[model samples]
Target: MCIVKKFYVADSHFGHERIIEMCARPFSSVDEMDETLIANWNAVVGDDDIVYHLGDFAMNLADEDRVRAIFNWLRGRKFLILGNHDYKRVNQLHPTLARLEWMATPTTSLETTDGGHRVYLSHYAHRTWPGQHKGAFHFYGHSHGNCPPIGRSRDVGVDLPDVAFRPRTFDELTKGMIE
Candidate 1:
């Protein structure tokens, strides 16, 4: 039997160097930002897991081949959820990218396992969106300006000073937030 390992990936925003600086304005130096992002990704991701890229994988695909080649080198089964910036060029290499609208709020149920479904992946938070769905934890990245809101069953993955919060695991996410 094939055992499946699970992992979560999000907005890498690769290629643009000094993204921390560039986001303040625009890229200036020739430094390769994607390389650092890739390294950070590899540091956390394991070989036997899946990576879910939320969106904004890069500023532009001027170097599509190099970007895709690096992504292909990463360790994991990558699933791309199209974000606002994801254009046709980026999709060319990662053809399996999924439409964000199709994903159910709370979480997307891939298997028929008994317990509650976990980790709703999205590019942005849906404070109103998930409230309507049944109980399921959601994970999303976007609004880097805001911190991960502690909801009953939700975790935001954007790392910002004001929004800097501990990322929840599948179990913690599904179980709900602590009061």
Candidate 2:
């Protein structure tokens, strides 16, 4: 039997050079940022783990090949909720990025294996979502820690304030919110 761990993260911006300055990331360079992110992610996530990436996986990429390498470097079974940059921000999926197996385009929802808690995943924040009134949890990226989470929602973006720039468990993300 295998116990699969699940983690969530977003807005990694792997190939984006200016994101380090724009998001005030701690790294001095894009390579350092990417390497650190990859290292942090693999430190917690395992090959059999599942990772829910809310969006903005990469930016300013010359090609998807680099993104592919990042993907290969990380350890996990990855899923994506397309963010503006993940699909090139033109309101359409980039031709090159279309080849990756994101498992879903647009948005998706799932019930946690442990508690059967419903989690709504999206690239952009939502004022209201399906099952919102019924206590469904929402996870999203794109604000880079600007927008605060309302109710059971949270921003899992890499640049979220006070975060360690890595994938985190649902419990870790929602630690103080549940009470």
Candidate 3:
């Protein structure tokens, strides 16, 4: 049996041009950024893989259809972990985006299928989460690399060079977690 992989990334901020300058992203244009992000995503994320987007998916695009189309281009079963940029309620999202059937509820906490370790997912960095003290890992975004890990926690935002503008598997995010 083949095992489906799960990946994580945050604050892609897809259509936001200023983000490139703000985050010092290497791309030369917003189109380049968007294309590269999508390419990088599809390169690693198989059709059967799972992707957890920590939020700030796309912004500055007034067209809901374009926004939905952008999302539709990516391969995988995607989940959202609502960030400040994503609006407070799912109903408030653009009609098209809101209409898409996400794989699960935005709120999430789970056990790693690979390690059996508890994991919490969010868009904002939390000083403490449900299992923080007990060795559970917390992954979040929004600071764009400003916030350091409190312990087994860190920013999974796409702007971070280490993440390379693509979703990361649990193992990739936790490789150094053992030390």
Quantify all predictions' global Cα lDDT against the true fold.
0.49, 0.79, 0.82
- How far is each candidate from the true structure, as Cα RMSD in Å? 6.4, 2.1, 2.2
Any runs in candidate 1 off by more than 4 Å, and if so which?
A: 1-4, 22-32, 88-116, 130-133, 145-150, 153-179
Put down candidate 1 lDDT per residue, 96-143, tens digits, no spaces: 222222223213222222234534567666674443355545556666
Best candidate, lDDT? 3
Clashes of each: 4, 0, 0
State candidate 1's TM-score.
Answer: 0.63
Tens-place lDDT per residue, model 2, 8-80, is: 8888888889998888898888899999999999999988988988777887655778877787888988887
Q: Arrange candidates, best TM-score first.
A: 3, 2, 1
Give residue 160's lDDT in candidate 2 (0 to 100): 76
> What alpha-carbon RMSD in Å does predicted model 1 have with respect to the real structure?
6.4
The Cα error of candidate 1 at residue 132, in Å, is: 5.7
lDDT of 2 at 123: 75
TM-score of each: 0.63, 0.90, 0.90
Question: Which one wins on TM-score?
Answer: 3
In model 2, the worst 10-residue window by lDDT is 106-115
